[model samples]
Target: MNIDIKADDSPVTRADREVEAHLREMIAATYPDHGIIGEEHGSTGADREYVWILDPIDGTKAFITGRPLFGTLIGLLRDGRPILGVIDHPALNERWIGGLDYPTRFCGAPARTRVCATVENAILAATAPEMFVGKPAFEGLRQRVKLPVWGGDCFNYGLVASGHLDLAVEAGMAIYDYLPLVPVITAAGGVITDWRGQALGLDSGDEVLAAGDPALHQAAVAILKG
Candidate 1:
């Protein structure tokens, strides 16, 4: 039940530290040559050919508030490209996983994104408007969408991959925050990229846009850029 604040003013709890440490141990033991990067523990061998990105708790605020909207995010980068991701909502007993060569799966079944090929028809969600501070153009993108709900954290991306949500956009994210979402959204027949419409990678900036349909993503990116 312990909680502490990180320098970025984000909350971190005992669960976050414990989970990340355990996962890091397992990964190090099983894949000694692969790199590891974690929100809590930092990185090691990050220049290796393969790296694992970890966010032990993607929605710590939601978790501390006793909401089930939190999740553990795990992503794999092969040569700096996101090739796989897993989002696990332990409290809800739901999970989503995907990879470049595999279709997305939710709760052991194949999952896919819903089709809404344009932004005007899409439902959008972000963690919060405050997260977009100084990025006024995000408001324009919000207005273009059919609906914009806030505060789902990483769960929103999993929903997009599962066909329950259409678009998820956010800024000020770290590699662990958005990397895990890349493969899940893309393998579900959706698209995920930065505001520039380029692929997400270790070097990508914080702005992220994910859509259940590729065309819809294109429209959203254009609005975000304007």
Candidate 2:
């Protein structure tokens, strides 16, 4: 589980591998028929109707840099759509959990997203600006938001779900990276989707947006789509 670099130059640590393995084992033992997909390991039992997604270390770069924003993401996909999700921040002792019919919760309390109708009043977050390097969509969002903070990874989605951050835009994501955020944000009265304003599915593309308010999401999507 030692640190290693992927061909994409992203960082992966022992903690990430170990955690994913641990979660996979638990899921297999409890739900043998369910599929599993993870960042450290590849997909398994993907043909099953129910699948579990894992991103053990959503922000390895932040973790390696001694930042507490790193998070562990877990999601349960029912019929290729996310139905349950959890974002855990070990260093911060914070956790956000939600499901299709379940209310979102943060640290034992009910979680709700804030309402910011306009981009000029929104607090936006992205993992890094470099992710948007030549992407016009992201550049549009960068210019529209009132405040743009960098480097939260999955935690930024959690913050949006818990009524902290107003919006989060990310590029170059995978199923494991963003799937776990869908339920949490949606259950908190927020909206999470692809850049084209389409519903995020198992095979959705990399670009993603999470906004605390539906109007704000629509506005942001308009800017990105421009």
Cα displacement (Å) at residue 19, model 2: 0.9
In model 2, the runs with Cα more than 4 Å from the true position are none
**Residues forming the 10-long window of minimal summed lDDT in candidate 2:** 136-145
Error of 2 at 16 (Å): 1.2
- For candidate 1, the per-residue lDDT at 64 reads 95
Q: Quantify all predictions' global Cα lDDT against the true fold.
A: 0.92, 0.92
What CA root-mean-square deviation does each model show from the true structure? 0.9, 1.1
Clashes of each: 0, 1
Local accuracy of candidate 2 as per-residue lDDT tens digits, 1-226:
3678998899888888998999999999999999998998999988789999999989998888899999999999988989999999999999999999998999989999998999999999998878898897787778878899987889899889988899999999998999999999999999999998999988899999999999999999999998
Q: How far is 105's C-alpha from truth in model 2 (Å)?
A: 0.3
